[model samples]
Structure formats: structure tokens, C-alpha cells
Target: MFKSILAAFDGSEGSEAALSKAAELAILCGAELTVLTMYRHHSVLEGSMYVTNADQPDDVDAIMSNHAKATAERGAALARQAGCEKIRAFVKGGPTARTIVGFAKEHDNDLIVMGSRGLGSIEGYLLGSVSHKVTSLAQCPVLLV
Candidate 1:
């Protein structure tokens, strides 16, 4: 039984499956759901420009931050539609796997539900999926949806 669940999403097709599964599990367990997304914290272009002018605005970072916020809003809407009353969302930067793992840890999540790549066995092994990395490293139980 899960009291708190964490679902990692990127507004991508793959994450759609994960969101649905997390919602189902949350509903069955009567658990609160938290959706998580990761975005790069800094803009490569702006960072590079800092060498010449450190006072200029960071256009790239602002652009990416807006995108991340939009993704979180969309995710929250989807979670609400899934009949989850205690749905929330958080955004972080850095590696996807690390972000998910850290968010789960920080939030005291009881379970993590993520999407499987559904690739062929060979492909899965050759190109590891984010779900695989997260499940393997997370401290709590993980459910692949």
C-alpha cells in the first residue's frame, strides 16, 4: 500500500504511459501523487556569453525555464483529470534519473511508477531506459507501468 507516490514525467510520449500507471496506482492505494520533471538549469549559450558580458540576461535559461514550467502545468492538469485529489508537481535540473531519485527521496515517496521503453530485449540492454536506471537506484519500491 502506497501513501505517497512519485511519477517522473517529461511531457513526452513515453511519460504519458507512466503518468497513467501512476494515477491508477495512486487511486488504488489512496495515495497522493507528485509529478516530477527535470530541466537543464543553465543555458549553454548564455553561459558562454558570460565570458564576454556577465551582466546580460540569460535568454536560454529563461526560455528553458518557461518550457519546464509549462510542462509541469500540463502534467498537473493530467494528474487532476485522473481523479487524484492530492496531486502536485516539482521541477529540478540535472540528470533525469538523479532528479527523479532525489525528488522521491526529498518527498518521502512510498512508491515510484515509471514507464518502460517497451523496446526489444536487445535494444533495452544496449540503450538502457530511464526507468531502468531509476528503479535500480531508487531506495523505495518501483513499479514499471
Candidate 2:
């Protein structure tokens, strides 16, 4: 039985499935569920390359981080609605697969549940999916939903 479960959520359809599965497993195993939402840091170089709205917030990175935190909170709420009693939500900024695996290892999560594909960019096709990288990198068991 898993004592701590980690779920990588990004508010996508696949992630929604993973969240539901994680909640079910958490309830069954009586484990504490941790929902993680990771977003890439918006670099100043990227922002400079793209035109910004005059009324847009100047702190773009903070805005993106806040959005990720909100997404994690929503995922945690869904888990609670799905009957998971012990739940926590976290948000981070980094590469998705590395962030998920690193958080799982640092937190000593027994199992990782995540989507097969997330809201990835074109690099996913050139490189690989986040789930694939996570399965290869993670020390614990990983379930892709």
C-alpha cells in the first residue's frame, strides 16, 4: 500500500483522469495525496520576443505561477470530492518531468500517478512526453493514466 501518493496535474483531460485515479488509490490505500501543478518559468527573453499588452501585468512569471497554483488547488478539490481525505496541493516552476520526479523523491512519495500527455509544447514531439521522461527518471512506481 502506498503511504504517500503524488499526482501530476495540469488541468488537461488526461491529467483529470490521472487525478481521479490517484484519488481512488489514495482512498483505498489510506494514503496522503499530493497534487502537483508545475509551470515553466516565463523568461524575460521570451517576453521580449513577444509583444505584451499595454494593460497586461508586468509580473508575467508571477501570474503564470499563480495560475499553476490555482490549477493545483482545483485538482486537490476534485480529489476531495472523489473521497480523498488527506490531500495537499503544490505548485512549482521547472521542467515538468524533472519537477515531478524530483518532488516525488524529495517528498518520499511511494507512488506517482500522472497523465500520459500534458499541455506540452512542440518540443514534446521532438523529444518525448513528460510521462515518458518521468517513468525513466523516477525511482518509485509511476502510473500513467
Candidate 3:
């Protein structure tokens, strides 16, 4: 039984499913549920290509961080709707898999639940999925939903 559970969410369909499962398990185990969403810090060149708002040209990282925070809150809302009482949501900017694993370790989570796939780019297909990397890196148990 888990005392604390970490759920990796990206606002993708796959992640939604994983969040639901994580919520169910947290409720069953009377564990605390922590929802995490990660965003990558974009370089100036990369940000310029993706920036749409001329007003906030150099705030790409802030924009992405805000979006990630909203995504994490949305996941936490869904978990609460599923009857989970003890829940917290967080957003971080870093390499997704490594960040998740580090957060889980830092928080001493007993288990990590995440989707097999997420809102990853073509790089994920070429390198590997976040879930795959997290499973390999995490010290605790990882459950891919």
C-alpha cells in the first residue's frame, strides 16, 4: 500500500487516464496524491519560433510554466472529483522524465503513476517515451496506465 503517490500529468488523453487510475489507487490506499506537470525551458531561438504574442515576446518560459500549472491543477481537480481528499498539484520546468523521478524521490513518494505516452514531441519517438525513462530512473515503483 502506498503512503504517497505521484501522478505525472500532461493534459493529454493518456495522462488523463493515468490520473484517474492514480486517483483510484490513492483513494483505495488512503494515500496522498500529488499531481505533477512539467514544461521544458525553451531557448531564445526556440521561443522566438513558438511565440505568438508580440506583447510577451520574451516570456515564453513564463507562458509555458503558467500552462503547466493550469494542467497540474486540472489534473488535481479531476482527482478530487474522483473522491480523492488529500491532493496537491505542482508544476516544474525541466526534462520531464528526470524531473518526475527527482520530484518523486524528493517527496518520498511510494509509487509513481503515469501514462505510457504523453504530449511528447517527435524527439520522444526517436529517443524514448518519458514513461520509459521514468521507469528506469525512479527508485520507487512505476505504474504505467
Candidate 4:
């Protein structure tokens, strides 16, 4: 029985499945459900490289952070619809896998739930999937959907 459950969500199909499962588990266990969405921080150099119009210069990191916040809200809404009463959502900017593991540990979550795959970039293929890294790094149990 988990006291607190952490669900890593990114507004993807796989994350939706994971969120549903996490919500179900949280309801059954009477645990607080926390939905987290992560966005990688963009360096100034990288931000500069993005195609931006002279009229409206886009801040890449701000855009990503906003999107992440929205995604977390969506996940929390989905969990509420699935009957999870104690639900919270958060958005973070960092390395995804490490940040998820760190957040779970910091919050003392008993279990971590996430999609087997997510909206990963080319670096994921070159390095490894976030789920795989989180499974390796997490101190608590991880459930991949």
C-alpha cells in the first residue's frame, strides 16, 4: 500500500495510460497522487538557434516551461476524472529521469509510475530512455505502463 504515488506525465499516449493506472492505484491505496511534468532547460545558445521572428522573439525555455505546466494540469485533471481525490500537479525544468527520481525521493513517494516511453528527443535514442534511467536511478519501486 503506497502512502504517496508519483506519476510522470508528459501529455503523451503512453503517459496517459500510466496516469490512469497511477490514479487507479492511488484510489485503491488511499494515497496522494502527484503528477509531474518535466521540461529540459534550454541554454541561451540553443534558444538563439531556434527560428524566431523579429517582431515576436520567443523565449524557448519559457515556452517549454509553460507547456510543461499545462501538461501537468491536464494530467491532474485526468486523475481527478479517474476518481483520485488527493491529487497535485507540478512542472519542473531539468534532466527528466534524474529530476523524477529526485522529486519522488524528496516527497517520500512510495511508488513511482510512468510511461514506458514518452515524448523523447533524438538524445533519448542516442543515450537511453527516461524510463530506463529512472528505473535505474530511483530508490523506490517504479511501475512502467
**Best model per TM-score:** 3
Query: What lDDT tens digits, residue by residue, belong to model 2 across residues 49-98?
Result: 66556776666777778789889999999999999999999999998889
Single out the weakest 10-residue window by summed lDDT for candidate 3.
Answer: 120-129
**Per-residue lDDT of 1-145 in model 1, one digit per residue for the tens?**
8999998777866677888888888888899999887776665765665443355445656655667778877887898888877898887777777778888988899898776653223546533467788878999998776
Please identify which of the two predictions, 1 or 4, would achieve the higher lDDT against the true structure: 4
Q: TM-score of model 1 relative to the true fold?
A: 0.79
Where model 4 places Cα greater than 4 Å from the true spot, the runs are: 52-57, 122-128
Models, CA RMSD each: 5.1, 2.0, 1.9, 2.3
What CA RMSD would candidate 4 show? 2.3
Lowest summed lDDT window (length 10), candidate 1: 118-127
Q: Residue 138's C-alpha lDDT in candidate 3?
A: 95
lDDT tens digits by residue: candidate 4, 15-86 = 999999999999999999999999999999999889865655399888888889989999999999999999
lDDT of 2 at 119: 84
Q: Candidate 3 on 28-120: residue-level lDDT in tens?
A: 999999999999999988887883676654678998998898898999999999999999999999988899999999999999999888888
TM-scores for all candidates?
0.79, 0.91, 0.93, 0.92
- Backbone clashes in candidate 2 total 0
Off by over 4 Å in 3: 54-57, 122-128
Of the two candidates 1 and 2, the one with more favorable lDDT, higher being better, is 2
Residue 57 accuracy (lDDT) in model 2: 67
Runs in model 2 lying further than 4 Å from the true structure: 50-56, 122-128
**What TM-score, to 2 decimals, does candidate 3 have?**
0.93
